[model samples]
Target: MRRSQRKQEEPDLGVLAGRTLFGLQRELFTRLGEVGHPDVRPRHGAVLAYLDEEGSRATDLAAQSGQHKQVIGTLVDELVELGYVRRQPDPADRRAKLIVPTDKGLDHMAKSDAILAGMEAEHARAVGEEAYAEFKRVFRLVADRHSGR
Candidate 1:
């Protein structure tokens, strides 16, 4: 095969997928800023959402968010300092701690949801509502399959 043909045959799916996802994340974060939640970044938002949904330990959040434990710990500390979240002693396991979002965190979550809803509406407008819904369904299926869930 010619060089060009070989290049075409070797699709860099991993690179392309990562670039696409990163681009979308950047765009979403920009929109979030526009929506007046400028202080919240994608990573912080992910941690908040995880705590809101599952209320896991710091170690678990680190694993689930694919962030280093120390990184998550630092972020959690920041969140705590900002009064968005608090760490309380776990009743079941005294030695362990459970991270819970404060009222401020919940408020932030509501704003984040509003921003994401606006983004989703824009996406539906661009791609059609039905198509967007189907895309989400298929994407979730693919994600679940890959994660063995």
Candidate 2:
């Protein structure tokens, strides 16, 4: 087979998938900024997504995000300064503080969900609903198996 045909037959899906996901993430961040969250950084996403409804401590955020406590603490501080999160006395630990999302943060989370839904709908339209469903299923399977879930 010709080199061009061989390349077409076995495209690098890893690169393509990564580019697609990150491209969407970039767009989401841009949209967030356009909607008045100019301070929200891409690095803050892991903490925000994993934050519990009640609240979480820096250590907990670190555990959930697979980051160091100091890194999570720094991100939490940034969130606090941005008015997205507030630190309150931790009921579990008197010396530590719990980070809770403010009303603005909750609104941003809701908007983020809507943005994701819109992107998924676009993917479905492009590849057909059934293909999109299969794609999601495959990704979930890979993630679950990879994570030993």
For all candidates in order, the CA lDDT equals 0.77, 0.84
Question: What's the TM-score of each model vs. the native?
Answer: 0.74, 0.81
Residue pairs in candidate 1 whose N, alpha carbon or C atoms collide under 3 angstroms: none
- Model 2 Cα shift for residue 104 (angstroms): 1.6
Give me the candidate number with maximum lDDT.
Answer: 2
Write one digit per residue (lDDT tens) for candidate 1, span 1-149: 88767656874656556776787778777876776556777678557767754356998887677788898998998888878789988778989998888876777777767766877898899999999999889878977776678
Q: Give per-residue CA lDDT, model 2, range 12-101, as digits (tens).
A: 766567777789889998988888777788899878878877888888788767788988888888888888889999997899999899
Q: Give the Å error, residue 37, model 1.
A: 3.4
Task: Report the lDDT of model 1 for residue 89.
Answer: 85
Identify the candidate with maximal TM-score. Answer: 2
Worst 10 contiguous positions by lDDT, candidate 1: 45-54
